[model samples]
Target: ENIYLNGAILGMRKREINRKFDEIVDFSGCARYIDTPVKRYSSGMTVRLGFAVAAFLEPEILVVDEVLAVGDAEFQKKAIGKMQDVSRNEGRTVLFVSHNMAAVRKLCNKGILLENGQLFASGEVSDILSLYQTRSIEKIKSKKIIENEKLGNAEFRVLSIDAISPEGSVLSIESGVKIQLEFENNIENKNIAISIFIVTLEDLILFEAPIIFSSDNNSQKGKYLIEWDIQPFLLNSGTYKINLLVGESQKYIVYKKDDILTFEIENALFDQGLNLNRLPGVMRPKVDFKISSL
Candidate 1:
């Protein structure tokens, strides 16, 4: 009934509402509760239903604000597809706002950034998202200390994590990068293993480098620095985040911190004509290929 009422308020005819009623209910996955009062619905259910109605109403312009954040993964995927259909197939416009950069990159061709209730920037989606990521990375202090109790038992204190080019210069796709991690061990006579995860901004773990202590070697109470090197041409041009994990014998975690550091690798100048930054996948290794005449 509320869906019908909203359709009426949106200037939709009663016949049109009836025509799309079943589709709206199906899309929302609220068929079982279609007859129930909306006041009894959960927050997710409410948002799903509301989005379904609004999206299926055939409005010339749709304004969606963080609606995907409330829906489950499946619902979010469906909602994105529906919005794309409305925009592409029906020749409508969708103005979407969200802090989820991955979703924004997937859904929008253009972007408008706001800061402190004022327009900060507006341009191509990729450029706007890159600027947003750079700003966020800039806000993170060079040295981050683990102060949250819920992250770990405080068995190990992370002093700092840094990623930079091998020569201590800016990182580029053609440059080998080094990750330097400094931490303090608060306990003695325990076996400690450290794992560093290189992840994408979308929270995808590309790979992990583990430093395992030998069985005979027990960790001592002291500060330690570990450096891991990534070869050049191994990673594509993009923003990458770091996750640090300290564990006992690589089985039990003693401390863990996500997004402890972030870095960007600019595209190599040699590939200026290739646009390698837009290439798919997390890695761009230099592979050897053999070609022969058959």
Candidate 2:
């Protein structure tokens, strides 16, 4: 089966592919799909079939990506169990990549943290997670505003930016929070457009807010405070950064900053054994699920 998948790369014949396919089928307990077309396979079946084929190859080292995320819960459990067995009994090395923190904690003994496409740190899984959490909290709590006069043009410059809590206290990732951006416009009566981005630790953008200046209004030159109210925010528990851009229009940029601000959301406990922090993905909006026996 391994040869069947790698036929194009290894330059194998049809007979060789079928021979290995039968062996993998017997080993993987996938006899039912012995003659099924690979293109017709569903996402979960494809992932399982790929893993099964790779496992049967008996290689000294295995590399895996997020394919395990495609399968159903039961299939995911089976795949993880098989990996554990392979690593423990067969003494084969497995490199698993995933954004599911809980699964990583359960499956791997060691972990590595990557920042900006570079190796940041490597240690025990718990220590790595602790390090990530601590650094995120410290970075966000210590910053009030990022003064970057160089990024601003003659018309406008950023003075400070900060996140505020709903109860007029320190910023906390609870329910209601607002982000305040302070800027000074030296030239008055000019329309300024502001673009804001909320990005994840992995540099993935989660949300964007744009402010378009109105031509109908005229204002004097002074400092301006722009607020972004995030009520009923659905972001998952993690560290995030904010990117800001100010310009005359969306096309022309006057000031731009990347990863200017940082914040962390603590784990939130919900009913029915649900932890907001433990959930996978960038955001977890409130969802309604219905279940009943058919």
Evaluated with TM-score, which candidate comes out highest?
Answer: 1
Worst 10 residues of 1 by lDDT: 141-150
lDDT of 1 by residue, 43-111 (tens): 999999999999999899899989988978899999999988988888899999998877898888999
Q: What is candidate 2's CA lDDT for residue 261?
A: 77
**lDDT, candidate 2, 179-209, per-residue tens:** 8988877756566678789987655687888
Each prediction's whole-model lDDT (CA): 0.84, 0.70
- Measured on C-alpha atoms, candidate 2 has an lDDT of 0.70
Native-to-model Cα distance after best TM-score fit, residue 231 in candidate 2, in Å: 0.4
Model 2 / residue 20 / CA error / Å: 7.6
